[model samples]
Target: MSHVYQELNPGPFERKASMMITTNLSVLINDVLKGAATLLNQNWAITAAVNVFIIFFTVFLYLNTSTTSDQVTIRSASNNAFSGGNTTTLKEIVFHPNYGGLWKDDLALIKLATPANFSEGVKSISIAKSLPKQGTNAVVVGWGPKSYFSTTDGILREAVVPVMNYETCKQKYYPIFLFTDTSFCTAKDNVGPCPHDFGDPLVYKNKVIGIFSGSFDCGSTTYPAVYADVTQYNKWINKVIKS
Candidate 1:
């Protein structure tokens, strides 16, 4: 199992970036050639050459295959967010704001807070207040890495994006507005949530309220990063817990 986390929509480079393709191709060619040899009674040296070539190709392909990582980074490299002690905390919880925050639970402890307000998707965990923060402006921290397809497994990253008005976000991603309860959306920017930032925190007012879910593939000027509306998911979360 590869450890690198994926973020953002798979761009052209990412789409074509499958490492397994080479392996698959090699296996198929080997099988086909071997089968053909039985029918043709071909020379063994030639078949052996193909097998050697396949091994070389497989090695190269494996090296070249890249896994997409989280784009978030800490503003303060020295600060530790989780355990408290550092003067500045750097990490944040982020929602992919695109891919439905798929790996969220793995990265974050998805807790359903009691005294539940009518809000959706709200969960709470204790993190140090000392770490670097974006202030009232929401911040996200994720365990996914920083580069797109660079490592089979990567580290977590953190970033921040402004939350747009709900009406404005509705105009941006209407279908999501209709179906999924995203509290708000962000304008299109390199910072907009892309792929792997799942279970990242969407912090506002010193609270980790949002989880990176998605607006992964679907994007436009209006439709940028979309997230799971923690305020809206309150009831749903409670259901899971109470059950």
Candidate 2:
């Protein structure tokens, strides 16, 4: 399989309008590739909702807010299978007001159509209040393919990746690409998320600090995997959940 990282154009990072798309993952990916960012304003919603038991491609980080029935979901387990877990429909989606272009503020809040009942297997995860220190070990969880050439195995997996310094990561993507302060990098290694791993969470000390955004080449040592730093958007998250 060929993994391509498309370069995004810099535009006004302002909240302009909102649009709704289907809940189909493949369709969403295609739209995103076709520059759906231009149509998606500050908040975008999906036509169909997702189950709370499994994570979908557009959501990550389940927040336990008492004000709303909608909760964020991450991409995990089989994308089309729900053999052993419960499922729920998504009610609404709220993307960051400043989200612009691909991998920039690549964060969103999913409101389930129905509230999820907390149980032993289903629970809310807290967002990171601060960024993790460089070299800290963080776990990336998803059901994406293990390698670029392999297909998705439908089994949820986790890999520990060390956080890379922003300066060091900046140098790696210098000239070709530039990451904003809202983003962070994980050291390049054989272990990292591949295609279909978008929206997966990167957790440090049980707090979600990152959301898998993009990678030049899956698991490429030359290019570290990038994530949207959740610490930079805690206030935005709270505001969305409460609104």
Candidate 3:
């Protein structure tokens, strides 16, 4: 939906794709009931406390795990950006730990670079091969909650959106892409990133290059904020991938 007169919204960065580990709510509840034993002191208060603890723990574990799907950075373009780097797959995303609804993978080897600005909105990138290998910075082609969830009471969900050069996106997407030095852009060709494909990758160079972070479909393309780009930090990728 690239257009003029309307603000731009160059979604977020791109990268290799990865699957996150999900949780089983039913199994979690069952675990609590199954472990409600052994501590049979007859003390009603103690018994109740024990059960409560188990339930809390199980729910916490289950909830935390739902967002474990690995999100590998994917390469979109096949130009000279990166012609001879590692070709990652969907299975490899699990190697990283999924916690707090954040893809905190290899801080060094893999990373979600600080956000950057493009034009109307912001941008972000996720790193696949750390600095030196590809570069120093990476992308975070993110999706879902623009901000982190304040309450961890439910399952973690992801979002899917588009990305474009901040300035370019602003011209065609929305004005939201114009934020600060910490944002960029991305989205689908017709409808931008949706809620289902949140945190998907936007492949770039030999390794994952950018991230699909944020977006706001406010009927009009004015306020759009997405993940930043990290190609600028390719130096970071080269330094960390080998070590």
Candidate 4:
């Protein structure tokens, strides 16, 4: 909903139209559920089957929705941002063995003590198995500072960044640190990730393909921001998921 509002910058009539559509959809779904419930008393067998089917269907829908939102909110180890405090805890951080100098293999799988509750606002995001073709448009979201020297007020901002070809990125970043083939780049003059956006997911078509690594300098129009390619670490990610 927020994404639509921000991306479209909808007018009053458009907003009203959207609200009507949403309200109608909600009413239709509720009516269906209520009708299903009405079957409970008359036919126990049918009701049992209906209940089972609904459970499974809802689960599948949630998995897909949550998968596209894997990086919902960022929280500190201690829940200083909330009054009730977050129940989730970081269980482990698995970094690539070769992750060092120039932040190569700058990928890590964070395990939670308990899985996050997948609902209307919180969910998981799917990770991409294949790299995005060069020039693909990707969405970058973060709660980072607006600029290199600014401070974050905890507002989430998003940008559409275009993927750059490797040779071009390599040429631009040469002499600093050659980006491993396992890394990728994105940039547009004054339109890219900032310093505090490190570790944020870079999503393409609702799948996370890379993570913000670093840039020659934040907000650099000349130097594109680099990201650790998630496609190259699928095996490691799967291993961690299984573990």
Candidate number achieving the greatest lDDT relative to the actual structure? 2
- Candidate 2 vs candidate 3, TM-score winner: 2
Mind giving the per-residue lDDT tens digits that candidate 4 earns over 1-243? Answer: 111112235441111111111001000021122101000011110111122233334434644654321222223211112212133333344556676545567655544445544332233455688877788888765544556676543334456778876667877877777467788888766566664456555677767777777776654548888877777777876665665
TM-score winner between candidates 1 and 4: 4
Q: Which digits, one per residue and each the tens of the lDDT, describe model 1 over residues 70-186?
A: 111111111122212111111222222233323222111111112222132222232222222222345544433333343212223335456665566566654644324344554
Model 1, residue 45: distance off in Å is 58
User: How does residue 57 of candidate 3 score in lDDT?
Assistant: 47
TM-score of 4: 0.64
TM-score of each: 0.40, 0.67, 0.31, 0.64
Poorest 10 consecutive residues by lDDT, candidate 3: 37-46
Model 2 C-alpha lDDT per residue in residues 16-92, reported as the tens digit of each score: 11111111121122112100110111222211111111234333434333323233322111223222344443466
Number of clashes recorded per candidate: 50, 9, 134, 6
CA deviation > 4 Å runs, candidate 2:
1-82
Q: Give the Cα lDDT of each candidate.
A: 0.31, 0.51, 0.27, 0.48
Name the better of 2 and 4 by lDDT: 2
Residue 85 local lDDT, model 2: 40
Candidate 3: residue 70 lDDT (0-100) = 28
- Positional deviation of residue 221's Cα in model 4 after best superposition, in angstroms: 3.3
